[model samples]
Target: MTQQHRTALKELQKLDSRIHEARQRIAEFDPRFEEVEEPALVLEGELNTTRNRLKEMKLEERRLESSTVDRRDRLRRLEERLGSVRNLREEAAVSAELDMVRRSLQNDEQEALGLIDQLGKAEQRLGELEEAHAEALRVLEPRREALIAERADARSELERLEGERSVFAQGMNPDELRIYNAIRGGGRRAAVAELTEDGACGNCFGIVPLQHQNEVRHGQSLIRCEACGVILAAPEPGSAADAAPAEASTAVTEVAVASDDDDGGDEEE
Candidate 1:
């Protein structure tokens, strides 16, 4: 293949890797979005439980108040009976009954007072919890909205990159495409590797032999660094001296291929 063709193939490879990375990022956010949902649901449930408890306490307080009124009425009737007693025995009996009714009233009143105290405290606590719940919803609502928008944007970007990658890959040869796919499948440092001054692979930083470095510079043959296994491209001429060897190698490969084809035809005839 021509040097230009090789360069185009490398560009396409890089684009394809970017597309894959974008898709992976979108996938990662999907679970994160769901993770946020669970906490919101849990908080809602807790708020509902607090509301129900508050309602129950209020109902209990009302029932106690109603009972107190009935007790008070009974106590008044017992006191009137004490005043109407005719003899010592009758007076003692009425006095005992009145004493019993008074005790009952006192007990009911104390219980009602206690219930009121409890209800007041519970209502205060409920109010605080409601406020907290409101704040939580307010905070989480915006975060959820932001995350939703982020996910949508990521998906859109991923789709666009994928379409671009498809276009990039259209004219690439199968072997070159395979090498690109293999590198991308490995990690983020796929397809593209920088040339080092010491003729080492940039991705792995391993020392590349002089022979391989020369081959990469020529840009005619598809060259991969043995140590890092990244596709090596020659740097533009006059840009840096480190890239000269690889560029020369690319030229050598092109000339060799041309000569071999010519010799083979002669032998076949």
Candidate 2:
């Protein structure tokens, strides 16, 4: 591969990493959207439960009303029998029975009144719950749409970056592409490392031999680090230089602009 191809590959790696991160960030927001909607969902569930309870209470009120009617009819029959009593003993027995029936009727009436009051209170509470549910929906509706729009925007940007990355990668040498893919597939963030000022591998911090360092600076051939198996490239321009190597190994001044991982050296002035 030409020096230019290696240069393009380096730029491609950086873009690829950025695209990956952008997509990851967008994916992360899915849960956030769900969280935003949770309050409304919870309120809806509560409202449904309350409405169901109100239905059951209404049914109970109807049952109580029916029972009250039955009791009143029984009281009327007892009174009519009292009027027909012929003897004093029978009359006294009828009076006692009449008193007992009156007490039962009064009890039923009191209970019916209490149920009606409860029904009124329950209806009021139901109205409040319904209003609360509507308000919750109103509050979140716009916020939810905003979040959705934000996600759509992020996705669009991710797609654009991906397209740029694909075109950039296509310009890279096939051999370089295979090597980079292999390193990335192994879960390493950087497929290549730039040598440090002190001639150390940027990824593993392992020292590189003076001879291999020269080879990376020239960008003529791909060189892998013996210690970490990462493709080694020379540091970028403007990086701090260590004491100039003794004359015997001083020829590696030119930088190849080769691919490096996010571990790109902090270039020193």
Candidate 3:
């Protein structure tokens, strides 16, 4: 009965591993979704920036027109005063002021005309960008919908597996299930592993004491690998399936460590 329960836990662990991978597959879609949306995002940003600039330019144009109006009123007042100047001195002073006001009004009118031209060009550019943005969204809709559908399918599979795990865990030995869940919590992936054929921990390659190895092989009680704390189940008879876990992890870790050392050396140089 204990052995049977241990086998159930191992099988549940395998199912959990599959669930983890399915989740990872679903997560991988996020980057692809972002990739597909990037062009539209860029265009939308440009559209917003251009629209804001257009608003500011229009405000500036209105301000210039208001200034032009005030200057026009001042020029009219000065010209009327010129005809009524009391002496040559007064007339000369009025004439000088009139020339200054006239030049200012002319400059304002020229600036307003230049801005009106710019406003026309800006409006045209905005129209072109709007059309392009609309076209991009139209072209992107199909691909984006396809990605959404694909991710939905992956999520559906994950839900099915989770339901299966929930159902499968019922009626198990409570103590054993509790232990399994505790070890599996917090994104820890390797909660249960089989003993390698040579009495070593499959997870970390540490040699299991002969006594514990015997207990694990016989499925006496749940024996955890002291080196890595993964629950040890017996490997399938006459199989090398557990042989590579430690080796593969070790190789990858070694390569990563070597790369780090090389980077450190370059930094030192």
Candidate 4:
């Protein structure tokens, strides 16, 4: 590949970097959106509980009404039986049953009243909870919409960048683009790096042979740092003399990173 191809690859890598960061930004809004709606969620839960309790209480009220009617009918029957008793003993027995039935009926009436009162209160509470939930949602709408719009904007930008990247890649040499993609597949940032000031691999800082440095800076074919396997490119003009002298070594290190697993280096300044 030519120097121009490496420069284009670096530009493409920069675009990909932005895309990665945009995805992360979009993901971050999930928690924030949940937080914004939490108040409404809590209120909604209470409203449902209150409504269910009211339903159960109304059923209980109906049951009590039916039991009251049955108890009244038994009381009438016992009163008639008392009048037609065979003797005083039978009359006393009927009277005792009448008293018990009256007590039970009274208890049921009292319980029914209490249940009605509780149902009224629960219904009121439910209304209040519903109102609060609506209000919570209303209060949160602006912020929620803002977050949504912001994330949408980020996504749009990401789409635009991706489209641009696709078009840019279409015009690039397929082999070089494939190599760049393979180098970046492992999530390393730098797909291609410049040769450092003193003939060292910029990515790993490995001392490159003078011959390799010359070819990377001046020739057209791809040259990787064998130690880390990062594609090397030509350094920027006037950078060599200005860069601080770095420590160098001639010991050759084994290539720990394969082509597909190799990471890219930091962006060039």
Candidate 5:
């Protein structure tokens, strides 16, 4: 394997990982994505609850009204009986009965009035809830549409990236692909790294010893960083030529092998 081939392999690994991650993310959001009809579902449930409450309140008002009518009919019958009284005892009994009926009618009227007040307040609240519900639906419509459009665009982009990744991966050996996938399984970043001007792994920024750098440059075999366990490659000719002197000068001045243990840390997706 030449250095160029290794670099291409590394780049292909990176692209493949990116494609896989994008696909996973898209899958997660497929069923209940923000772009779907979530807002409509929420609004529908709320509207149904409010309408049910309104229906119950109206039924209660009708029941109260019927009770009031029944009380009025009783009072009318008692008033008629008062006229039939003939003796003092009978008249006193009839008068007492009339008084009781009047008191009962008054209580019924008061209760009816309270019910009317409550019904009015309930109607007003229902209207407010309806208005709020309408406004929420109105606000949610455009947002939902926009999200749907965004998802569509993302899907299209993901498709294109996947195609590109496929093309790149087709050129790589199965063993290379396996290694790349193994690294990606641990985290989002798949490729270990290439060498930088400072003789360090580009991904981990850990120092690459002179021997390791030569191995990576020669491309006799695939190389992985000892510290970070990332595959390493050399930069392109133009960059490598420019980097060679700085690396040589640093190595001469330091007179000590740079530690491979110093890691630059993992790259994020």
Candidate 6:
């Protein structure tokens, strides 16, 4: 009964650990989902940046046009005043100012033209980014849906295993369940371990006393390794099976010697 209960507890511990892992796997989807959306996010960002740049270029073009218009108006006023200038000094000064304004207007117009070219490129790039985003969605849609479905399945399995663990725990002794749950919840990989070949705890590699080994081997008593609190079970059946051949060979030798002794006695008779 003790060994049976311990076996049940060990199974419970495994189920709990599996449940933990499944939950972790489910949690991993958050980042993975974000990763799937990353291409669209990048495209949207690029499109927004291009649009903003285009706006700035257009604004600059408009400003340059306005400046050119203002300069032209000033030049016209100065030219009108040139006809009224009586002295050569006034005429020369007015002519120099007109040249400066004309040059500024030309420069402004050239800059505006350059801004229009930039705006055209930006608009084209924005269109390309939009198309790329749409294409990415088309390509990744299936993968994203698959990921979502996988996460859902994993979550469902986790829930089912959690239910199974609860049901399994009901069959274990309260004290043993408490101990197992404590060790398992405390981050230990296993709450129960099989005794190893050298009579060490399978989990902690701590030496187990012979007396405890004997108790576990009988399969009638529960034993815990003293060094580590994990419950111990007897070594599995393979070790005992390995000794069977040696015992068979010894029996065959004994029969041969007995037969030789009988033949010698018969000869003496």
For this target, which candidate reaches the highest lDDT against the unseen true structure? 3
lDDT of 6 by residue, 81-143 (tens): 999999999999999999998888888888887888888888888888889989988988999
TM-score of 4: 0.78
TM-score of 3: 0.86
Which residue runs does candidate 6 get wrong by more than 4 Å? 27-42, 217-223, 235-269
Model 6 global lDDT (CA atoms, 0 to 1): 0.75
Count the clashes in each prediction.
9, 0, 0, 2, 2, 0
Instruction: Give each model a TM-score.
Output: 0.56, 0.69, 0.86, 0.78, 0.64, 0.76
Q: Please give the lDDT score at residue 108 for candidate 4.
A: 100
Off by more than 4 A, model 3: 238-269
Per-model C-alpha RMSD: 8.0, 6.8, 12.6, 7.5, 8.6, 12.9
Instruction: Report the lDDT tens digits of candidate 1 across residue range 86-137.
Output: 8999989878877887788788788878877877877777787677767777
lDDT of 3 at 242: 43
By descending TM-score, how would the candidates be arranged? 3, 4, 6, 2, 5, 1
- lDDT tens string, model 3, 164-248? 9987787566677788899888557888887766678878889999899777766567799998888887664324434444433
Per-residue accuracy of model 2 over 117-200 as CA lDDT, tens digit each = 887887888888788888888988898899889999989999999888776676566777788889878988877777777788
Candidate 1 displacement at residue 106 in angstroms: 6.9
**Overall lDDT per candidate, in order of appearance:** 0.68, 0.74, 0.78, 0.77, 0.68, 0.75
| Tens digit per residue, CA lDDT, model 5, 177-250 | 67776877887464656678778888878898889887776665678888888888766545454656654443
lDDT (Cα, tens digit) per residue for candidate 4, span 1-269: 25556666767877888888888988898999999999988898888888889999989998999999999999999999988999998988999999999999989988988998898899889888888988999999999999999989989988998898898888666777888899899778777887776678888898988878767765347788888888887764434435644432221111111112223332222
Best of the two (2, 5) by TM-score: 2
- Model 4 lDDT, residue 179, Cα: 87
Pairs clashing within candidate 4: 190-264, 190-265
Q: Which residues of candidate 2, in runs, are more than 4 Å off? A: 31-35, 62-115, 239-252, 256-269
Candidate 3 or 6, higher TM-score? 3
* TM-score attained by model 1: 0.56
The residue pairs in collision within model 5 are 192-230, 204-264
| TM-score leader | 3
